[model samples]
Target: MIKIAIADDNSFLIKTAQEKLSFFDLAVKLIAVDGKDLIDKLEINHNIDLILMDIEMPEMNGIEATNFIKNKYPHIKILMLTVFDNDENIFNAIKAGADGYLLKEINPKDLHQGILETLNGGAAMHPSIAFKTLKLLRNPQDFENRECQEEIKLSTREIEVLEQLSKGLNYNTIADNLILSPSTVRKHIENIYAKLQVHNKLEAVQKAKSNNLI
Candidate 1:
């Protein structure tokens, strides 16, 4: 039986992870509310083989916990399970020694595959996140200087698409509002992510706002 642990602040997310793990017939040894709790639990029960860690938590974040865990328990693998896929967070997690990174929206099959891959001494990353990791490796200096100082250029339609995204609207809704096809809206979003150098909608909106582009 593969021993696993989950650490997340949200009870709902914790339950969701538990449900997904149940499908694989693996043993869930521990469920921690936050990073600190995870460390404390490991003190008593350090027999876990893997940990599904959440990035944002109260007391201590996943990155800090990963650093601590790796130093004390090098044998245990940690896979980051989070919603935020921004470059900064991803870079920090890798630097802190996370074995793998997967978004929370992953289905059960992929999550299981990711866990297995990590245990087999392989890194698992979402395709988009893998692309960003390659980008970071290609230009380490760019990641070090992530703050956008120069003006960013975005087309007028892209700005409109971003505005709708900021309002928490889905692609279909945004397409309907802009009177564009779903494929066109998706293309606009892809362009926005590339132009802003962000990986997700939240990051794109925040970057655009900070740069005074939207």
Candidate 2:
């Protein structure tokens, strides 16, 4: 089995990811609540093959963790599984030596395939993320521009998800109201984050309202 470590603060997300991973020959060897927790656990057991890293975590963020890990354990591959897909985050993750970057919305089969591909020395990226990666490469200087010129577009469903998130509703609750699966709600939220260039619900909500998208 491919030994993997998951670094996410949300237990529900962790459980959901675990359930999807169960379909493959992957073993979740360790679970860390955040970047700091992941670092602490690696001190005890550093024999894992790959890490499913979340970007936004308390104590230490994923970029910091990835930098430290790649520096200390260069042999171990770090694949970023995150909700944020903004230009700066993608640029920073690549700069920090992440082996691959994938969004949280990816399906189980694709995620498993990505893990296998990353283990085999290939970079794994969600298709949309792959396009962004190419754009980042072509215009590295664009990283300096924090403000995106493109219009902020939130789909009808995404706006609904954002509106629900603004009310401090959890994923399952939002899923129920929207008549979407929890996973689908999660995907919509991820899209919202990427579009708004925000990491969390509060930021997403604030940006959406400021842009009059909600």
Candidate 3:
């Protein structure tokens, strides 16, 4: 049986995840309330193969926790199951070493499949996020690539906005930093999103990173 651990702040979510996981008949070895508890469990049980982690919590967030896990137990696969779609969070999670990224709204069957696939040396992402990943890849203009006469035109201000966004800044923060009204910032972001054909920040940043735009 594949040994798996779950870390989430919500007791209901923990129980729900445990129930969903039980259908697969894999060993549900541990459940942690926060990042610290998760790490503590990892200390005692080194055989866990996969972890379903939540991004937000009291003691420590999932990003920091994932980083610690990857440093100490590089072999353990982690699948992020959180509500946060912030580009910075997603990129940081990827950098810190998450095998897959899934949302909390995922169906139990898919969640089980994601776990099995991760354990079997494959990566998985939510379908919504996956779509964004594709759009980001096709944007040659975003990254520095020559030999293209036809390119999506982006104003300097728009580029500036996208660059900050690619760095993981939220709309409000980006607006404040740029000294623009929140509405103006939102408009610029909307234009960028439309030009890039991406739905969310994570997708936009992923595309930018792959192109070395940020």
Candidate 4:
């Protein structure tokens, strides 16, 4: 039986998921109200087969938690279940090692199929999100394949900063949001611009967007 755990803020969601999975012949081992709870459970028992994680939660959101789990337990599979359809959340979750993403509004049958696909080592994305992910992965601009793009070299943190900036956030806001010192935010921005060969924020953001760097 697949041993699954769910981490979500809504009790209704937890109950609903439990009910839906009750007939699947799988074991629902744990339910978490937040990322921290999920982490604690994993620390005590690392036998989880799959995790359904919500994007937004109290203390350490799912993206961070998923990254941590993937690093610590590379064999486990994570499927993101969230209400958000935003590109930023989708990209970040994918970057953080999610194996699949299914919107909360997905029908129970589709959700079940998604779980099976994820377990079989295939990515399952909500139809709405799959389009964006494909665009980023397949059709990155400059009309060049991303792997062949020799001009772009950005560190992971710098890419994070650039992603935040592309969302129209300023350095101070990015600093506060990422819990980085303001000076550190500035330094990342400088590095991003230098890597992208852009002189100003507008140009940097435009180039990044055009090239799908963020």
Top-lDDT structure, candidate number: 1
Estimate the overall C-alpha local distance difference test score of candidate 4.
0.86
Every candidate's lDDT: 0.93, 0.90, 0.82, 0.86
TM-score winner between 3 and 4, please give it. Answer: 4
Off by over 4 Å in 2: 145-214
On lDDT, the stronger of 1 and 4 is 1
lDDT for model 3, please. Answer: 0.82
RMSD (CA, Å), each prediction: 13.6, 15.5, 12.3, 11.3
After the best TM-score superposition of candidate 1, give how far the Cα of residue 190 lies from its true spot, in angstroms: 43
Candidate 4 global Cα RMSD? 11.3
The TM-score leader among the candidates is 1
**Count of backbone clashes, every candidate in sequence:** 0, 0, 0, 0
The Cα error of candidate 4 at residue 136, in Å, is 2.1
**TM per prediction:** 0.69, 0.68, 0.63, 0.66
Instruction: For model 2, state the Cα shift of residue 121 in Å.
Output: 0.3
lDDT of each residue in 1-214, candidate 4, tens digit only: 8999999989998888888777677798988998888999899998999999998998879999999999999988999999997766877798899999998887778888899999999999998889878876665442344443456888888888988998889879999999999999999998887888889888998888777776
lDDT of 1 by residue, 1-214 (tens): 9999999999999999999999996889999999999999999989999999999999999999999999999999999999999998899999999999999999999999999999999999999999999998899777665545454678899999999999999999999999999999999999999988899999998888777777
Ten-residue region with minimum lDDT total, candidate 3 = 141-150
Look at candidate 2 and tell me the lDDT of residue 125.
Answer: 92
Query: On residues 1-214, what C-alpha lDDT tens digit does candidate 2 reach at each position?
Result: 8999999999999998899899999999999998899999999999999999999999999999999999988988999999999877888899999999998888999999999999999999988878999998998855544334246767898988889998999999999998999999999898889988889888988877766677
What TM-score would you give candidate 1 relative to the actual structure? 0.69
